[model samples]
Target: MGKNYFEDLFEKAFVYIHYDENVESCIFRASCWLKEANELYSSSQWMSSYILYLRVFKLVYIIPQRFRISKNASYYNDLLQIQKNTIQLTERLTTLQKRIAVMHAFTPIELSHVLQLANHHDPSTIFLNIYAHNSSKEYSFSSGTVFLDASFIQNNSLDAIRTVIKTPHQAHIKTAICYSCDNMLDDANIASKIYLSLLAMGITPRFLDLNSPAKVGKNTISISPVGLTNLGNSCYMNSILQCCFACSPFVSLFIDGQALRSLNQNNPLGTGGKLTTAFTSLSHQVRALQGQGVCSPKDFLANVCSIYSEFDTASQHDAQEFLNFFLDSLHEDLNSSAGKAPLPELTTEQQAAKERLPMSHLANIEWNIYKRRNSSPIADLFFGQLASQIKCLTCQRTSTTFAPFSSLALPIKDTTTSCTLETCISAFSMQEVLQGNNAWHCPKCDVPRDAKKTMSVSRLPSVLIFQLKRFRMIGTTHRKIETSLEFKKRISSGMIVPPSFQSSIYYEPVDYELFAFVNHYGDLENGHYTATVFHNYDWYYCDDAIVQPVTDFKRIYQNFSTAYILFYQKVDAAN
Candidate 1:
């Protein structure tokens, strides 16, 4: 037989599986790796099985050391030995499973013994192998092989099934029969007798036929670099999904296995529930994919349209707008706050006085208090604080107010050639004299006065998202800025500090590295959105469902004119 597609990969994994020794803190990851190994082994994918087994072997050995309880050190040591022995036994049995893959010549007694041993280890665990071969048909099984569908299994009946050895019941017998396979060499009379005995024991067997080939190969191509099927005009949702999931923290949240449970436990209503569902599916899909995988945001788009009627139309919408709504929905569900609370009620006179008070004064108090009280996981990680300092030229008094922002909106300079990202950031934090109608109302002066108004980064987020102000309204006509922008791999917080605060660089300087990009192609009225993300140290461009690997970031993105949003992660924070 010719070598299988995964044959070479399997050999590499087998070496690691046999000899691996490393320790890590996360026990959940070890457990998940073991589960993946077992599942792959059962599915007859030896290459995936080999890879996952090695992962489990390394992770399982580390579990004992991960425990910090000094008193239970010996106990953990003993537990490790038990697990090691179990894995060794499993590894030996894996060899047997491979040998039995094309076991047409096996006798009834040998077949029965193999099935009994496999089932003996764990009743719930399934170890599958092809029984016979027929050149004419694609799928061929033994004459009396019982096929079991997953839906037929019930949670309540699990106890009866688990107690098969000590207290065999109808459930146990049926489950075992469903998991069994019998060859043509087995006596028909004996098979009939076995069937009769099972019937006498109140166990009835159900079967579903299989049509797939016996010695099947993996779908290495079709499964990955997945193309998403567009549902109407869902490119907006698609683009957002690509960038969000590609984020390392976001991917870790799901793979570590807490985010889904949190979302499911606190199942919010309407769009929240649907968004949760979509994330749940996305998380699983991301984990399950071996390489680059295809994704579709049809469900996510449907949920968005249901909540916001404007999205129901096929017309394109702003990606940033959709991102805000998506994050807000997630925040409502995943935020640290127990739930949303109404603003405190004020007396008639107090409300009137509040309206009279300068908006910045109220914002300095209420907004800051509110932000501290309701710090969400998303907000805590992604929200940056902006300080608006208004210095009264009349009294030499300065008023500093803060507001939380998810992304920084920077204005692009009208340059023919290329503009640097640093320059755009510098322009954002530039100080301006607010005179005329735009004058600041200083409470110290009790009147509108000319003031130096400057906005600077008070606090930086782990992930910094920058949105370029590309769409400009020019007398009922929206125009797109075609100014080419070039971004470096690393940038300092000094670039975003106001010119007046240039001395601030002497203090601790925050360093941010490029992590993701949202590129807008075409014009303002009609444009397509795509994302280029850095994941697992490689760059991949995701356009809707189609994902293609990119080698050189500078070659593709350097001086790109259509860049809309650039995502950066703090080097220290990312670490």
Candidate 2:
């Protein structure tokens, strides 16, 4: 019998599976490779080809490295052969495109893996030979395979999920993006680069910001170059499923071995300005990705090696190290600083670049700190007493202590008196989310008439800012407020620093008679400015956050932490 579809492409892969010792292993790898290869043949895009190459390349490189096997020479040799085949196929297709004659370029080297039949350039050879041949159809959650639904994936949440999925135990899922232009049209440059990289990994790469997507609704982001209908049943098609991959030090795939090398060699992070900030932020994000459950550190390294195989191993190592260091920052907010040990003395490196090094400080910040929920009926958890005000009893005994949502590690003042957030809420918000006309109200806490703070804490939120030169994130999530990838061009695109509208980049007072009267009267008319109608009155109110009881301490704790992390990080970083 002839070899299978995948086996034909990788002739020497028999040893990878140890057909002589473990037939099942060999068959499984062969089956996987076969399915992957056929998927490549069925597509005309290079994106899929790149992915397929990485998929096969990983295992091909791994076996030789770990086992010191003789498969090294053969694997590269096989790659050369496949490259040769690909070139020949391209030539054939090109010829067919021009010629008005019948032709056959794909040689029938193996039978259908599913039907035990010969090839005919149809789905039979591709699908049957690989996917169908593998009889195992059922999937368990615990299974190693990451069956990511590609259609409805949220382009915005891609980075978050990438981080979560890489949480040591999870498998890498293929994300899909818009196969449109290279978003290099100016402000779209950065976003375009992100999408292009995602294309190779199957992440959603599109040029649209999908806010408020629903499970079933009419909200479809018209950003797809190929239209949504072509996405079929893939979860990535739904507008509600977009996960943005606009990476900063605080976003995207972290712990990339290759990235570490490049960052150290060429771009030593934390130089100030936008470029340095972006790289440092990117490192943090990639590190967080490593913490996710989707992809493992090993897998990430392997993928890097395969796709960026041309780079020297040392460069790759630097890239990975840098990636890990940046990710380490995201392990928790680089700020917050809950621990109580004094910071170590500055090292030589730290001292040499003391000015260049990042510093932590508490700046202009407003928070809505709340007590732990006294009761949570929804999750079936309960609490007794909830403190109304935050306390730090040890303040009297400890030295002058400060908690300014720091970037570097610092010790808490003292153990006896903790700086814990008490019962009341102290929430802050972004201006972007405040643009809507209707005021968000919550019956339990704040309606339009209730506490303004509560109303401002909850409701519709802005995750990121839409700027050209820089991307800012909402709250402090230690992530970007708005996805830079949403835009196509970079600084050149004018989106970051769009053409200045001389009319109002700052404040715009409402039209009122009070202003007219003020002009008629003297400066401050009499003792105080007379109010005709209180013309410059503030009218906007944010969404209300109804404080519920904390039934589950852990859940509520995590929720609080998530919010606090972002809030303080933003506040401190800004300072």
Candidate 3:
């Protein structure tokens, strides 16, 4: 077949499928084509099966557009089934092509081309056949074809292939396997180098045990905790960076190269994605170190300083302030709604209706409005809504406003020598009287009057951060609160959300697990910051260039007086 054979076939199929045809007739034709395609697939006729599948998909695509089939209709399901079969068959054909290209006689450049094509689409699985080679004899080591995740191979093609090729052999034995193309000598030497380098770097690929037939190749790479080399007085930045890296979901987006797609270079509020690019490069370097050595964040710091001039100096800063700016900058860089028009203002009637809606619905509406302007992974994971209600003393009317917050700042009472986190949260959500200069201007009564203000968490983020207000100005002197604040490893949303808004706002019970926290020592003016993070089911204290495992929770709990910022991640309800 010619190189353009599939393209030509698809074009002709589209031309033949009548868009004006009846919905039932088109569905029937698609169903028949799908049946034949499945048969051809079963018989291993990939080319013919893919052709029929493409044609069926083309027919099914126009059914809804031309006839507008109702989703509840019986034929709608049939059309859906046909479309699913076609999609599955298309993926199978693509995988088959990749396998054939890999197994056949091909050069390094040819294999690279095949891999490039395979990278465009995601395949469910790929098979690797491993054989053991020794001085005496050579034989198949794997019982059968070994299954591997196609995405893993797509990302780390050479490393994955090397791992699979070296899985069954002992370290002392020199093995040569012709897994790809006819250039066995060159490929084998390359694979050997990769395997040795991987071992030296402490990245052992996970593979199925030969004794376990049902197990599949996971290709899991272990990441070690690599310390950051601090540039003078950069402990505050380093501590926050360590905590951000501890976030699996946030770091994976950069480590896996998925954040690049969402990078908004055109955003005026952002650093033209320069910060995100620098951060991604830093993440790669951190992973490459594999805990064997320290990684310098000079490049990332340079990028940060270019945007925010305050961090350019060699002076210690507040970790919480840096964290807020860092998250906000990343959010702007990756904001999906960058340069997009804001949502129109709601009509008066709509506003009244919105006020009448339930708290959940109102929160969703507010969130949608916020997302239209500030949509990003950072917002999705770290942002939550705070509801503030103000009751007018004169008019006896109340108004509620919803605002977004990245972190909750809780105030510590000076009278308490020892306090619990719940007490702080309750203090944060409690109501207060507003009078004198803080009196509210009543819009309905047209006068300034004393009012009562209440605050509550209306929405919860997947990851939550709490900043303890330890530093306060006491009569023009900066003083630090040395009160011990005790907290648990896990906390429920009920502790943060008010009792009145619990059932109405959150339908399901939400829980948060403490993963990381920043601690400050010494006075507020000249303090050192260190972070303790939970990674891989173990706790580690990260102090700038030093990373150490913490086995004793009692010792860590005793030093809670210096804890400044707490990080929590929402537990998956399904898990």
Candidate 4:
């Protein structure tokens, strides 16, 4: 029902990344190779696999030299590196990826860390890299890696009217064609653009500006997060992480998906401790919201607002715990030579909107909660400045508060590899029983002449996140009880329920039937620059309460298209 077409593309990426089918043989052969080499003295050595591994090392040398920011460099270079790193690392694993040999038991914390890394891999990194590239030229991802600036976007990509226009205002934002991704026009961003175009037409009998409480507009801007407004407290972090999880249901490598599959070899449990805490908080609040005796729609609205107020307050409270971390991350950059310029207070209307909320308690809790924020290398990367470090929440080991802190993310970042399934199996499977058969010498796996064991090869499973761009909540304008199902049935039915490792669960479906965003462009932030669109760069995830669909890399552009058209033609992408 949601972006079914992206399945093919996701499979392609998975196959390329995991190098499925023969990974087991490779592990086995490496194990055998080392065993044989050790068994034979210096007088008799079989270094064929080791020699072949050295050949893989050549791949490492070859890539960084060819790393250029040129035409079509991202997908290919990234894919190639992913492949090369897999070969190199797999060859190095002491267990050779054998399930029997690899340890079956792992501590919860240990499991959490590995799952976190496995889920938070390069695809997200690559997607963010491209986003930073499009928003501003000054912000490079490599620099972001070094600097940790989360706010940087390429400012210059939009400065000139560099693109060749096919038509003028005739092409509404909803149905714009992007040459990227082979010009697939049937996308969520395109759908949202159509809806946006309807609004822009002024032909509709009803339309109004969201900025005004009365709803009036000659022009309208979708007030999400962008520009100067930091969603008070750690709402920014919570909201973004929530959006990522909501958008990417196919994501099994994450902590939540531990219910579905074990992505980490060592970890039986999934990701960080965040999901459990967040879910517990959300559940309790939702239950209390339902208990209110409703007299009318006003009562219902009152209830919702109450729940939202409390939820956000709680969220902010949790966020404050990390303020020391966030602040430490930014302080160094704030003091840097480049940062000596007056650091402008980035503000937008949302902050002002917070002032109008009816709940005084929530208002008090909002900004006061995350009053302290430090810098990260990521933040510095965005701002072209250096940030200070914070304490590691996991180890409590104090070094620099930086994310790449020695005690925090150990072993740091590593490369990955990929190759054709057939080629990998064929090249590596060349061994026979040590006693007697004519074999070229199996470099991937070796079996004892008489060992008793059973083996099974199932689909090596993994996932990529894809976002649903046109998806929207249905009842925000009117506080109506939209569902007919009872609460028990809803829970049991897995309706909008986040899936677990063993359970095949789903959450509330995107209210796609009621909304559509057909448009000339789709960008993540839902902005427009007077009708200028950046094609492939349009779909970037914008964080707030509204959930999106499709985090898959292929469909991210659709988000770009929606955001591009809305921002450029209606609002302001530059803002």
Q: Pick the candidate with the highest TM-score.
A: 3
| lDDT measured at residue 520 in model 2 versus the true structure, 0 to 100 | 9
Candidate 2 vs candidate 3: the lDDT winner is 3
- By TM-score, how accurate is candidate 3? 0.62
TM-scores of the models, in the order given:
0.54, 0.17, 0.62, 0.17
Model 1 alpha-carbon miss at residue 95, Å = 50
**Model 4: lDDT of residue 34:** 36
Candidate 1 per-residue C-alpha lDDT over 262-328 given as tens digits, one digit per residue, 9 for 90 to 100: 6533435224456656676665675567555555556656666777778763788888888778776
- Per-residue alpha-carbon lDDT of model 3 for 1-575, expressed as tens digits? 24564465455333133323456666766776777767765654444455566667766666666675688887777777777776666566565444323222221112222233235431321223233333212322223334333333434656555565444423533222223222222233333443353445344422222221112221122345678887988889988988888887788778877678899888899888888899999988888986667888999999999999899647788899899888888899999888878777777566646655545456767877788899898888999999887888877666678999999999987765788889889889888999999999876677888999988898889899999998999897889888888757888776686544442312234568898899999886678989988876688888888998889987578655568999999863211
Q: Candidate 1 local accuracy as lDDT? A: 0.56
Compose the digit string of candidate 2's lDDT tens values, residues 132-206.
Answer: 112332321123322222221334365643442343422343322121121121123233333344444444322
Which model is ahead, 2 or 4, in terms of TM-score? 4
Best by lDDT: 3
**Tens-place lDDT digits, model 4, residues 235-330:** 323422322222222111222333223212222221222232333333333234432321112232223224234424223332222222322322
Ranking of all predicted structures according to TM-score, beginning with the best and ending with the worst: 3, 1, 4, 2
lDDT of 2: 0.23
Error of 2 at 434 (Å): 48
